[model samples]
Target: MKVLSKSISLFVVCLIVITIWWIGTDGFTGFTQETARVNKLIEEKPMIMPITLEDSKGRMYTFHELKGRRLFLTFIYTSCGTVCPQLEKNMQQVYESLPREILDEKIMFLTISFDPDRDTVEVLDTYRQYFGSDGETWRMARIANKLELKELLDAFGVIVLPDRYGGFTHNSAFYYVDENGRLTNVLDYKDIEGAQAFLHNELLGSEMK
Candidate 1:
């Protein structure tokens, strides 16, 4: 009876260990699966609808100009004090980690402000300065037209809601587009390491093609 009880206890402990391992690994496994799924979706539908937007200099920008460059894009507003700052910081880290050749020649980093009413071209320029961005590799912009902004946000799956403190809450992530302008991957801001890995392995080399 004593030996049988000991064996049962050992089996239960092993079961618990296995359960913990599965739970710990589920997040990475899920992210990998999601990446595969999104890749397949891009393969099926190659083209994304083009939208016109304005940069901090009040100059018109379009997707056509982004062709043949790996695009790292995100949405943020100057008034946001919560996730936006950290999200941008993570992007900055990813940008700094890359080789200068990739940053200057092969990649474009874009931050678009969803709050057009409050985030004018001047305001975005100030915000860009605060982040120490030179606007060469990392460019900040805002959508001028309300209707077009709504369509752009909806297309990218960004949801914005008004908060009680006169600010807004929104989902933030990096939208990764290939050199061909195909929407490829959506990396959440929390996955900084994953973003860096994708940049080094997929974007910088010929593996992505």
Candidate 2:
């Protein structure tokens, strides 16, 4: 009788272990499937911006260049005393935390300087160094004129004004574009972690179980 009771107890314990394992496996699989579905949905609805502009290297870049990659964009000028630096710093963190595969395979970063007259290629090069920018992968382009700058800003609903001290007063919003070049979300300049996770999970497909 004692032996039978021990055997029954052992069998019950094994059965429970197997059941827990099964549950865990199935739960993980479901989560993976859902994540893939979400990414596909996002890709299907990418935002396409019709920006026809030149980079610091004088190469023409537009919405078409972003067809197969995610993009992070913001407006800044080299001589700004505030806000622009903070936005660049936040972007650096986001860029660093991104997986190399995503950075290589699915991501691009663009910082277009709103001050055309001042932010020449030389100034952009200097500014890029402050952010440890590698010219091949990342870019800081200067707008050709105030009119082009205003049109782009208006299209994106970003506003800029000059202060009494010749400084810029501008909205600090970081724009996120998806793999299909669709503008997906706007992040605050200080929201580093939120932006990090947002980019990591969506652009890199990190939540792909």
Candidate 3:
């Protein structure tokens, strides 16, 4: 009877472990289940983050104000002088790939500064001009409220860490939001070709409807 009891306890422990693993891996999808689950969640129920934003032009607006326009959004801190500049340049190429006339109204490129205290309205405006952005179609904005900034970053999975050089080390990615304002996809920062292709298919092929 002791032998049977011991066997049952071991089985129960193993079953518990398996259950934990299964849940962690989202039904055993993969070892990197966090990414898999996030992708799945975005596809199934894309999120809409409601946060107030102030543009470099000193214009304040809520995220809901951008509804009915497709957005290619990303985060940046102007002082970086390296990663942030490259990200802007790369996005510029993708921005130029599309027709200028079709931009700003239907589709927009928004770069939000996580460090609003340092990257003031004037700072962001100056930084954007370095990359030839007209400030209308390709906008630079910031979240002045620190509390709201944290919430927005967490919602979008953007990780920003302070560096020894008084700058930030943050993940770079283009977050694509559809016309309905739902964050549908997150593309890698270096994927220039993929970004262009998505724009072409999304705008050139189906923009009219």
Candidate 4:
């Protein structure tokens, strides 16, 4: 009787452990699948809508208006003393390296200030001038409306967190939009070669098309 009772207890413990393991594994798998599904949905959608925004010059235009030109865009704020400047510099280098025809006629660069409250038109203009950005080819702008700003950041997958120093800690990346205004590729801000290659391929592919 003692032997039978011990055997039963061991089986029950094993059964309990197996049950818990199965439940945990199943839940994890489901969560992973859901996450992947959501990511796919986001990837399939266009990066920007036709929402109108104000530029540093206070000119109103929708991103859709830029449909005929390839766009390289990044998020930045005038107050940022760290990553934003580096990002702008990298973008400038990429812009300078590209063929003048592409730079002049086919491509454009945009630096958008996420901190709309503080980064007014004057502030953005000063920031652009500080970077010595050519106002025509390289433009700086900000979305003035708070709600629209959040929506734009979310669309670009940019997460902004307030740092201890009253600056922002945000996702830093270059968003490459095709001539048709589709979000074709996203590269790290540090990847100057990658940005160039992407542009080359995109321009070539568009020519072929």
| Candidate with the greatest TM-score versus the true structure | 3
Q: All candidates' lDDT scores?
A: 0.80, 0.74, 0.85, 0.80
lDDT of 4 by residue, 152-194 (tens): 8877677799989989987687887877777766786788888
- Candidate 2: clashing pairs of residues: 46-182, 47-182
Error of 3 at 191 (Å): 1.1
The order of the candidates by lDDT, greatest first, is 3, 1, 4, 2
Q: Residue 159, candidate 3: how far off, in angstroms?
A: 1.3
The reply for model 3, stretches above 4 Å from the true place, is: 1-41
Q: For every model shown, what is its TM-score relative to the native structure?
A: 0.76, 0.71, 0.81, 0.77
Q: How do all the candidates rank in terms of TM-score, highest first? A: 3, 4, 1, 2
lDDT of 2 by residue, 7-47 (tens): 99999999899788667556344344333333443445445
Residue 133 in model 4: lDDT: 80
How many backbone overlaps does candidate 3 show? Answer: 0
Q: Write the per-residue lDDT of candidate 3 for residues 109-172, one digit (tens) a residue.
A: 9999999889999999998998878888989999999999999887877779998989998777
Q: Best-fitting candidate, measured by lDDT?
A: 3
- Evaluation by TM-score, superior candidate among 2 and 3: 3
Superposition-based RMSD of candidate 2 using all C-alpha atoms, in angstroms: 13.5
